[model samples]
Every structure is written in C-alpha cells, then in structure tokens.
Target: MTTEVIKKPPTWFWVVSVIALLWNLMGVGSYLMDAYVSIEQLEAMSQEMRELYEGRPAWVTACFAVAVFGGTLASIALLLRKKWARPVFIISLIAAIAQFTHWLFMTNSVEVYGTGVYIMPILVIAFGVYLVLFAKKGIANGWLK
Candidate 1:
C-alpha cells in the first residue's frame, strides 16, 4: 500500500491560520448582528442607515450569511491543516463577491454611506481571495492533508 506524507507547516502558517479564524469569526458576528438587529438597535441607527439596512434584499442577506459562514468554516479547516480549505475558501470568495456586487451596484450604499463604506467591503473581498490562495499554497506545499 502506498502512503502519503504530510509536512509540518511553518510557524507563519499557524499564525496566519489563527488570524484568519479570528477575522472570519468577526465576520460571522457581523452577519449575526445584521440578521438579528433588535428594534431598539434599528431605531438607534440614523434614518439613512436604518433605511439601507431594512431595504436590503433577502438574497443579499443570504449571500452575506453564506460568505461569512463559509469563510468561518474554511478558516477552521485551514487551522486543522485540511486540504478542503481551498475549495471552501473559494466558495466563500464567490459568495462575498456576490454580496458585494449587490451592495456596490444594485444599491445606493455609496450614496447613502459615502465612499467610506467601500473600504470594509474591499478589505473583506481581498482577504477572502488571499485565504483562497493561501489554502491552495498550503495544499501544494504539502502543509495540508
């Protein structure tokens, strides 16, 4: 019987994986908050913000859930040094792209929240892409099994 060997990942790999997990956990928190904002919390928002939040389409919210949830799972997989992290990251990236596409193009988020709103979404997308590439590299380098 043939056997496959897995190499030990470098320290930086562990560091990055932990950071990714924390980041995606924050994303999951954001998604949860958005999904279950209380009436008091909603009322606390400015009119523009409240309207924007309430007006978001269900599909966009669904994408948000998938993106954050998928990324969180992928991060966990990465921490476990699982090769499946790559595809999970890819799925998360796709969902992130879809969610941001609605926010950037299908809505007046920029007009309502100004250009400042662009920063977080851009960062989210970039990080998602980085994670995908990182997972792929881990697989290629035999760091993931």
Candidate 2:
C-alpha cells in the first residue's frame, strides 16, 4: 500500500498567514465600528471626520463591508488550504479599489484630512493587490488546495 504524504507550507507561509489574519481582523473591527458606532460616538468626531462619515453613500458603505469581509474570509480560506481563497482575495482587491476610488476622487476626504489620509488608502490598495497575487501563487504552487 502506498501512503501519500502531503506537503506542508514553508515557515514563512504560516507566518504570513497569521499576520494576514490579524491584519484582516483589524479591518473587520474598523468596519464594524464605522457601521455601528453610537450616535453620540459619531458626534464626537472632529467636524471634518463627522462630515466625511455622514457624507458616505450607501454604496460606499457597502463597498467597505465587502472589502473587509472579503479580506477576512479570504484569510480564513487561505489558512484552511481552500482554493476559494483566490477568488475571495480578488473580490477583496476589487472592493478595496472601489473604496479607495470613492475616497480619493468622489469625496473631500483628502482636502479635509490632508495628504496623510492618502497614505493609508494607498497602503490598503497595495496590500489588497499583494494578497490577491499571494493567494494565486499559493494555489499555483500547491500551497493552497
């Protein structure tokens, strides 16, 4: 009888996986807070931030939900060695791009928050793109089933 021994990912894979999970969890927390904060809490923000938050359209909020939720689920799928991670990560990247587009072009966020606000969005988009490619590579290399 032949026993097939499955291959395990390298050390960096586990490290990256855990870090990705933690990172996406933070995004989920931010999304939850943004979506469900109390009226009083929302009122406590600086006028610029409050205005920005209040001005967000339903579609923008929905994009935010998709970005965070998709990223979070993709992380889980990656850890579980599921092939579905690729598509989920791609979804996350697209949602993230949409969110960033809204913030960068559709809103006054940059004018209100100064150029520093752009940095995070850029980072998020870059990370989103990286994760999509990462998941694709994982699948192609047999790190993900």
Candidate 3:
C-alpha cells in the first residue's frame, strides 16, 4: 500500500506567504532595534512620546524579542512546511493577541500624534487571525514541506 501525498499550493498561498514573511521580518527588526538601542533613538522617531523604560527591564525586552524572533523563524519554516511551523505560528498568534490587548487596553485614552492611523489596530487583529488559521493550510496538506 502506498500513501498518497498532497503537493503544490494555490498561487495565492505563495503570494500570502511572501507577504507574511515580509511582515514578520519587519517585526523582528523593529523589536531588535527597540530592545537594544537607547531611548534617544525612539524619542527621535517620536518626540512627543515619552520613554517608558520602567527600570529598563531586560527580561521584558528579551521575552519580547524572542516572540518576534519566533515569528521570523516560523515564517522561514513555513516556506519549507517544517513541523516547527505550527508551534511558531501558535506563539505568534498568542503574542499578537497580547499586543492587541496592550494597545487596546493599556494605552492612554489620549491619542498620540503620528501613531500611523487608528485603522492599524483593526488591521493587526485581522492579520493575526488570518496568519494563524489560513496561512498554515499548506503545512497541514503537506505542500509546504
């Protein structure tokens, strides 16, 4: 008896996967820069926003960086349909939710200037759900590996 394997993805999957990789890579770069650089760098980017370093918590920064790196690695594994994709995606899903919560619940009620529009929060929620559920279909179907 031979086990049949599914092969190849729809063209859209390739397109979405590329988009997801680019998105995750940006997260990796932003988190890395924020965690390592001085507050002056962030202040220069946003002069109105005050730094909230809370004792300069290294652990918090490390964990945040790890979450971003996990997403980056998962996006890479996704291209190959590696088994690690699901767990990595899961981590990203949770982190995305946590980030969404922080923005929605923890931020000040007063709006900051140049926050890049209010629609960003909604887009993030939509993208988080899409990446977690639909993006991994190829991995499940054995087309990714």
Candidate 4:
C-alpha cells in the first residue's frame, strides 16, 4: 500500500489565518451595524452622511454581505486546513471588488466623506486579494488539504 504524507504548515500560516479571521469578523461587524442602524442613529448623522447612508443601493449592500460573510467562512476554512478556502477567498475578493467599485465609481462617497473614505475600501480590497493569494499558496504548499 502506498502511504501519503501530510505536510505541516509553518508558523506564519497560523498567524495569517488568525489575522484573516479577525479582519473578516470586523467586516461582519461593520455589515451588521450598517444593516441594522436605527432611525435615531440615522437621524443623528449630518445631512451628507445621512444621504450617503440612505441612498446606498441594495445590490451594493448585497455585495457587502457576500464579501464579508464569504471572507469569514474562508477564514474558518483556512484555519481548518481545507482546500476549499481558496475558491471561497476568490469569491470574497470578487464581491469586495464589486462593493468597492460602487463606492469608488458609482457614488460620491469620496467627495462626501472626504479622501479618508478611500482608505478603508482600498485596505479591504488589498486584504481580500492577499487572502486569496495566501490561500492558494497554502493549498499548493500542502498546508491546506
């Protein structure tokens, strides 16, 4: 009988996986806050902020949900050493790009929120891409089965 050897992941693998989980959890928290903001909370915002929040399209919200939730699941899969993490991370990355595309191009978010608004979306997309590449590398290195 032929035997198969399982490769052990490096320390960095665990570190990255944990970071991914925490990042995605924060995304999920952001999504929840946005999705469930109360009327009082909305009224407390400045006119521009209120308009931006109330005027967001439903599809953009859907994309946000998919991106954050998918990333969270992919993070869990990575921690579990599952090969499925790669594809899920790819999906999350695509959704994050879509969500950010709307924020960057289809809306006046940058103008309303000032240049500072760009930072989070840019970081989100960058991290999404990084996680996808990391998962692929993990699979290739036999760190993820």
Candidate 5:
C-alpha cells in the first residue's frame, strides 16, 4: 500500500489568510473597545466611523463588526481547510451585503466624503467575489468535505 501526501495550498491562499487574520484581530479589538471603552472614547470612535461612512447608523456599525468576526473565523478556518469555513464565508458575504444595504438605503445622508467614496460599493463587490471564489476553493480542496 502507498500513501500520498497532498501539497500545500497556493501562495495566494496564505496571503488571503494573513489578511483574514488582520480582519479578525481588528474585529475582536473593536468589540472589546466597544464594551470597555469610556463613553467619550466610544463617541470619538463612532464619530470617526460615521465620518468614514457618511452618517451610517450605529446598528449598522455593530453588524459590520459581526460580519468581520465571521470573516475572520472563516479566514482562519480556510488556512486549516476546515469544512465550516465555506458556510461562514457565505454568511459573511450576506452580512456584508446587508451592511452595504444599510449604507445605501437606510443611511440618512447622500454626501459622500470625496472622490474615493465609490470604493464602498467596490469593496462590497470585491467581498462578494472573494466569498464565491474562496468557497469554491474550499470545496475543491476538501475543506468542505
């Protein structure tokens, strides 16, 4: 009998994994800050975030944090080729869409910050594509089995 050892994932996979790690770490830190920070600090952070988002609601900000947490876990699982990562990634994509929708429809303002404000839509689209591609890759690599 012969045994075969599979090769490692592609370099891009590792690169994505690193990005995911950063996302997850940031997500966790935000939650911690939201919980432990002083009211003034929270307000300051919220103000900064609002400026970036053009007056998006506070609930949207919280949901965005949840999505980041999901994405971070999914990304880590992807590194280990865990089966649940695909579903988590899908959930993250849906959450991202929901987050974007909050910005597009529910948000009270239309005054985009600057020329680069269009990047928000582009980021959502990129996240959607990333979710699809990584989900397929996860399945192909036996991560979803």
Candidate 6:
C-alpha cells in the first residue's frame, strides 16, 4: 500500500490560526470575568440587567462555559494541526447558539440591553461558524491531519 503525503499550508494558514487562538483566548477571559463578576459590579448594572444576570439558569451558565472553553480548545487543536479541530469547533458553535438562544428567548435581553447587545451575539455566531468552516477547509486541503 502507498501512503499519502501532504504539502505545507501557506503563510495565511498560520496567520489565521494564530488570530483564532488570540480571539478565543479573549473569549476565555470574558467568560472568567462573567463567571466571577463582583457584587459591586453586579450592583452597578441597571435593575433589569441585574435581574437578568441573577436569574440566569444554571444550564445557560454551563453553556457559556462550554462555548468559550470549547472554542479555546479548538483553536489550540487547529494550531497543533489536529483533525479534531473541526468537530470541536462545531460543538463550540452549537453551545454558542444555545447561549444566544437563552439570551434571545428565555430573557428580555433585547428589551433590557436594547439593540446594541445584538452585535456581540451576532459576531459570536459568525466567528464560531467561520472557525468551524475554516477547520473543515484545513482538513479537506490537507493542512490538518
């Protein structure tokens, strides 16, 4: 039997992978701060916002954990040239969607935070989908193994 050899990816692949890693690291930092937000910080929020935060379901919190942590792990996997990055990124996207769903449906986030809050969620979904597709493209093009 013959074995297949793959060519090295171009400079853009490394560039994108590093950017993805840094982006996900920011998500991780955001999650840590959200999880550990101080009482003073909580009190500083508007009453509606405070209620939204204090009343969040535990499962939604878990989804936030899964979304950021999974994305970070997927970014690391991508940089390491691991084929597992695709599925892990897909999982991260699903968790992100779930978190967004909670914000859009289970709570009055829009009513409270107004239209500006939509930007971050939209970016989160876009970036999550982009990373998953990027990983898939990497695998298909033999940049990942």
Worst 10 residues of 2 by lDDT: 2-11
| Candidate 4 residue 84 C-alpha distance from true site, Å | 0.6
**Residues 21-127, candidate 4, lDDT per residue (tens digit)?**
99999999999999999999998999988988889889999999999999999999999999999999999889989988988898888888889988998899889
Please give, for residues 27-83, the per-residue lDDT of candidate 1 as tens digits: 999998888899999989999888889898898999999899999999999989899
| Candidate 2 off by > 4 Å | 1-6
Q: For model 2, give the RMSD to the true fold.
A: 2.8
C-alpha lDDT of all candidate models, in order: 0.92, 0.86, 0.65, 0.91, 0.67, 0.91
Q: Please, what are the lDDT tens digits per residue for candidate 3 over residues 5-106?
A: 768777877787778789879878878666677766666654335434343345555555655777778777777656667678777767666654554456
Error of 1 at 26 (Å): 0.3
Residue 103 miss distance in model 3 (angstroms): 3.6
Model 6 lDDT per residue over 1-145, tens place: 9765565988999999999989888989999999999999998999999999999999888988999899999999988999999999998899999999999977899999888888999999999999999998998898888
Poorest stretch of ten by lDDT in candidate 3:
47-56
Across 1-145, the per-residue lDDT of candidate 5 in tens digits comes to 9654445677877787677667667766866665465756546654545465445567676667767788788877777867678788777777777776776656433454444545765675586567668767756774444
In candidate 2, which residue pairs clash? none
**Which stretches of model 3 miss by more than 4 angstroms?**
1-4, 42-48, 51-63, 109-118
**For each candidate, what TM-score against the reference?**
0.95, 0.91, 0.71, 0.95, 0.65, 0.96
lDDT measured at residue 107 in model 3 versus the true structure, 0 to 100:
57
**For candidate 5, what is the total of clashing residue pairs?**
0
lDDT (C-alpha) at residue 46 in model 3: 48
Better of 3 and 6 by TM-score: 6
Clashing pairs in 5: none
Best by TM-score: 6
What's model 5's TM-score? 0.65
By lDDT, highest first, what's the ranking? Answer: 1, 4, 6, 2, 5, 3
Per-candidate clashes, comma-separated: 0, 0, 0, 0, 0, 0
